[model samples]
Target: MAERRVFITGTAGFIGFHLARLLLAEGFRVHGYDGMTDYYDVRLKQRRHAMLAQSESFTATEARLEDMDTLQRTVEAFRPDIIVHLAAQAGVRYSLEQPRTYIEANIVGTFNVMECARAVPVQHLLMASTSSVYGANEEMPFRETDKADTPLTIYAASKKATEAMGHSYAHIYGLPTTLFRFFTVYGPWGRPDMALFKFTRGILEGTPIDIYNHGDMWRDFTYVDDLVRGIRLLIDAVPPLPEARGGSVPGANVPGDSLSPAAPFRIVNIGNSDRVRLLDFVDAIEAEIGRKAIRNYLPMQAGDVPATWADASLIHALTGFRPATPFREGVARFVAWYRDYYGR
Candidate 1:
């Protein structure tokens, strides 16, 4: 068999970096595209790209996703067997301030990617969604089959819109698409804006760490490695077209399956099945760093939900895997990497 090639956007981003590394190790030829946005630290993104460049099979282009001409040229040049659209304007809170960026990057940019996928008609097209899309729901664990129409912020709304776009393309073009809704993912090489990085920095710098919602928050925190592994396995579990499955159903009989009866598309939630409290998460960071955070309790910010849990059973059914990293262990590993990376 020829070597499988993957064209993945946002390779310099946290999850993208990990996923690219995993696929490279598995002998997949990967072409990465990233905007190298200043949303976080550009230097951090550069370092990630530099690391991936060490592999001969890994190549990258630094450009924004909204640049359709360049994006189309790059994708056409790569001729990938699979395309994973992971680049977007991230951050739920940031979306409240810069709503237009979300529209350009998340909505317009995603549409461009889907168009490319439709043209190439790859074996599979996997895109990223978020658990934040399950906003305002009073449910304990969010299943893929659950309604995700209550996106509170433009960031969540953008991802939700992309899910719809993907489904439409799948239905019309017979594209095999999978959109995975990720929960709170943290680990080494995480974004500086996430809670773990912010809390660790504040603690080490002797600054105050803001505990949101007065420490009443809960998250289904997933480790980056486990999350990427789920992604790697899911690449091959392409949803079959309804007619292609012939007489019977491929995933219809499976309970909790989010496969659309009209198209070769499905939505899966990738998250740790366990939800941990915000205070307990901070405690774990303190335990790992041997320094206590100067806590400043505050009300939940706008567009913030009190808790998010995922029913990850569908991923398990499709790929025979579930994220199992304990949040405490994940936090400790992150702190260790932070110390080594920053010499703190």
Candidate 2:
């Protein structure tokens, strides 16, 4: 559509880095904003940014989302027509240790982004949410309409708040916003805190990989490329106004899969929809490395869910595509990239 200018937060982060590169490759001028926090490895984030910097259409600004003044200046300078809010204090386990970090980065930080979007007004505003919000729910597949009242961790709670805040802003200002709830996203350039990355690192280092819940956990692992493709398709699928605000008749009683029906805002799960066991995931990595992992089976960690399965029917209905990358292929690609990147 008209050479769109895209502004994204957390470019140094895994999904953000991949999304930035994807957009740049598609001829979109990309503006990356990141705080470069030392939560994991600053060098890794910098490396992701460095790679994006090679693209002529890519420009980056180092700024924290909590710093509204600086963020405002950066946003104004970029003048993005579409803004993706991916920067946040990530990690469910880390949230238990540092609750305030989640507040400042996710809650307050997201508010600042909404304020900016309120001022500039974009064609579509997309933000990241996690499947963790399904907290305490034992349902097979999570739907957006599911009651997300019970958040096990501060990180999930903050994201839930952001969704509510975004809905309010959209209702009041007529802003078209799309919320993407990602399920176990993994691939090259993935965050070090994620399971796949950790498992690979430990296996390569001859260290034991912690198998939580005795390796019974299941996840809808989505490859980075597939997740980004879903996003690219949704970039143009701006939320349509609900047909009936006051009353509903057809399909009103149906309840499953996450899709908002009230405002010009919706939440869709971008995932493979294939739930693979945790042990199987580790096995795939081990096979890719040609070495078995030293496993340390343990009880499930606090704020950790036993399983996550994405009902991506809405995503397919909207985008006409679903994440088709099998775990073996996606994991192998990550392992190859990981080995090359670490020179192992």
Shift of residue 321 alpha carbon in model 1, Å: 0.3
Residue lDDT tens for model 2, 239-341:
7556643244322233343445566788888988889998999999999999999999999899999989988888887768999899999999999999999
Winning candidate number (lDDT):
1
Residue 88 alpha-carbon offset, candidate 1, angstroms: 0.8
How displaced is residue 327 in candidate 2, in Å?
Answer: 0.3
Q: Pick the candidate with the highest TM-score.
A: 1
| Model 1, global lDDT | 0.94
Q: Give the lDDT of residue 318 in candidate 2.
A: 74
TM per candidate comes to 0.98, 0.94
Segments in model 1 whose C-alpha atoms lie over 4 Å from true places: 246-253
Please give the TM-score that candidate 1 achieves against the real structure: 0.98
lDDT tens digits, residue span 168-250, model 1: 99999999999999999999999999999999999999999999999999999999999999999999888989887755555
| Residue-level error in angstroms, candidate 1, position 249 | 7.1
